[model samples]
Target: MAKAVSDSAQMIARMAPVLDSQDYCFCHVADDHKFHAASVLATFREEEGLTLVLPLAQAQAAGLAGPAFRRITLQVHSALEGVGLTAAVAGALAEGGIACNVVAAFYHDHIFVPSAQARDALSILQRLSAAARR
Candidate 1:
């Protein structure tokens, strides 16, 4: 298994955020649809309904719509218990006036930025990483 990084500085220095080419959106799962877990990127159950992060195309095909977002995957395998990485990334993006939604899985942290601001978000992250290496 790949080693996980717990050092905040190392995690920031090696984040290697890569933007996904496809667009995605968050939408409520259809009331009557039974979605296969593997088909969607992520899901969260809430009091209202299931919220799904789905490819923009898939969501549009299913007649669901929301603001488009681009996923930036931090390639660093940050340990689950690690601190500051998310805060640093979010703080950087926030300083650039970009809102960020983060999803922390076992392996990597994913940052979702507005589709229109994806490149800007990626640049901010790259600079953050470069600064950490300096």
Candidate 2:
């Protein structure tokens, strides 16, 4: 059985904002469609074709190129319907003309946005949350 999300907006409310102010260097890692490769965090020789986040500090320390992506952490108590959440958020961002990448963990959902647009995305999410509350 799956626990249903009663309020989509409320779920977004509980999410913590991850501010991104620097560029993060991210690679495709051999086009395998997997980001879990051991070398994903390593092997940074140049910055071509890499997705840069923001700040670039944290990513650099980890041997990752930067600015770092702005991330939002949503703690979904129930099993997340990736399609639903992604569609909702992606729609919101798309409306704002912002690009997003989503990653799911065991207990939470994470949204990654371009560093420059993080604040705007947060505002949009906040609005979505408030709307859900209604």
Candidate 3:
């Protein structure tokens, strides 16, 4: 029998743990802008806006978004519950006094937190995963 989406171990494992040592920037450009072609780097876009992840220094030099945003990547299965998953992770981080901004894609969820709080946010996620397993 095919595995149910909720019970698939492989799906759960797809939530890869990303280290929180890097700083990233979220950029927003005009919908018709072709900035991607202007650079060789990969950029992520959605119906609402575009987000680019670059080194903090580079982002600053490029004069992108504000300096307050921190970038984090979370490996989550496409089949996982959206609000529930985000809420859980956010709740955990909130308990630790961390702020977060989350973006969900077709295959994974990305989180942005204060650069200084990345480690704590990551540890909160690790604890969430461990708690879920039990």
Candidate 4:
């Protein structure tokens, strides 16, 4: 089994960010709507409702006109105890005037940025990794 990385520097250096082709959007469903686990990427329960990260087409079909996003998966097996990766990523995107929504799964970290700025976000992440390699 692959071991998880906890060191911040190692995580940054190894986090090879790959931008997904599919555009996605966040939707809030409070009613009795059943979204298949396979259909949606991820879901979070908040005080108000359940936030679902779904593909763009699915969201559009459901009549949602929210902000679209592109996912950038940080291909590093980071431990839950890992530090600084999210902060560094968020800080970098903030400097670029892009908002970031991060979902830290068991394996890798997924970053969602505005669809229009997907390429820009990917470039920023690549540069971040390269800099960590220096």
Candidate 5:
């Protein structure tokens, strides 16, 4: 089993950033819309609808529309019980005036930022990690 890392500084210092190529969007699919394995990155049941993180092309094919965003995976193996990593990472992005939507999974944290700001976001995260190492 992979050890969960909860230390804020270590999480930051060890964070290896990976930017995904495909554009994505949050979409709401009616209960009747059949879900295909390829269309979804993540899903959540909501009172209003089924919320999903889906690839832009797939979402568009399903009749959903939205601005395109890029996915950035923080390659640090963040334990689900980790503390402060989200806040610290979010703070850095906030300081850079970049908006981020974060999802914390069992092994890693994913950040979705607008496509226009994706590179900048990655740079900011890299700098944050470098600073933490000092």
Candidate 6:
């Protein structure tokens, strides 16, 4: 397993932005439409149905509404038990009037924001990183 970073400053400094071209969405997988593709980004089972984050094209092909989200991946590896990293990131984005939905994987932190605001979100994050390094 990759080492999880706990230092907030280090995490911020290393938050290289990675943008996915395909728009993503969270939708309930229909009974006839199970997401078995390896490319499916993530999934969670819920009482209503299977919630999934998959490519916008795939979701459209599956007849789901477009989620129209841009994914920004933080390159830093953050520990699941790490403190304040999420709070800091979220706070920065919030202060910029950007809504962020974050998913913490074992190796990295993924943030989903509105596609229209993606570029501005990146700028906000970059500034946050720069400020942290000061």
- What are the Cα lDDT values of the candidates? 0.94, 0.59, 0.64, 0.93, 0.88, 0.82
62-98 per-residue lDDT for model 6 (tens digits): 7876658989998888877877778988999999999
Best by lDDT: 1
Q: Please, what are the lDDT tens digits per residue for candidate 5 over residues 87-128?
A: 988999999999999998888999999999999999999999
Score every model by TM-score: 0.94, 0.61, 0.68, 0.96, 0.94, 0.89
Candidate 1 residues 26-127, lDDT tens each? Answer: 999755668666769998888788899999888888788799999999999999999999999999999999999999998999999999999999999999
Model 1: runs farther than 4 Å from truth? 30-32
Per-residue C-alpha lDDT of model 3 across residues 1-134, encoded as one tens digit per residue: 23324433443334455865656666666567554353412376778777665666665776675655555666655454534667676877889999887777656677888888887877777767766666
Give a tens-digit lDDT track for model 4, residues 27-101: 999856787779789999988889999998988998764899999999999998998999999999999999999
Better structure of 2 and 3 per lDDT: 3
Best by TM-score: 4
Tens digit of per-residue lDDT, candidate 2, span 1-134: 23545455545544544444434455433333334344332332334443433335644655556444667666554356534566677898899998987766656666778877888988887777666556
Model 5: C-alpha RMSD to truth?
1.3
Better of 1 and 2 by lDDT: 1
> Between candidates 1 and 4, which one is better according to lDDT?
1
Report the candidate with higher TM-score, 4 versus 5: 4
Instruction: In angstroms, give how far residue 20 of model 6 lies from its true place.
Output: 2.4
Q: By lDDT, is 1 or 3 better?
A: 1
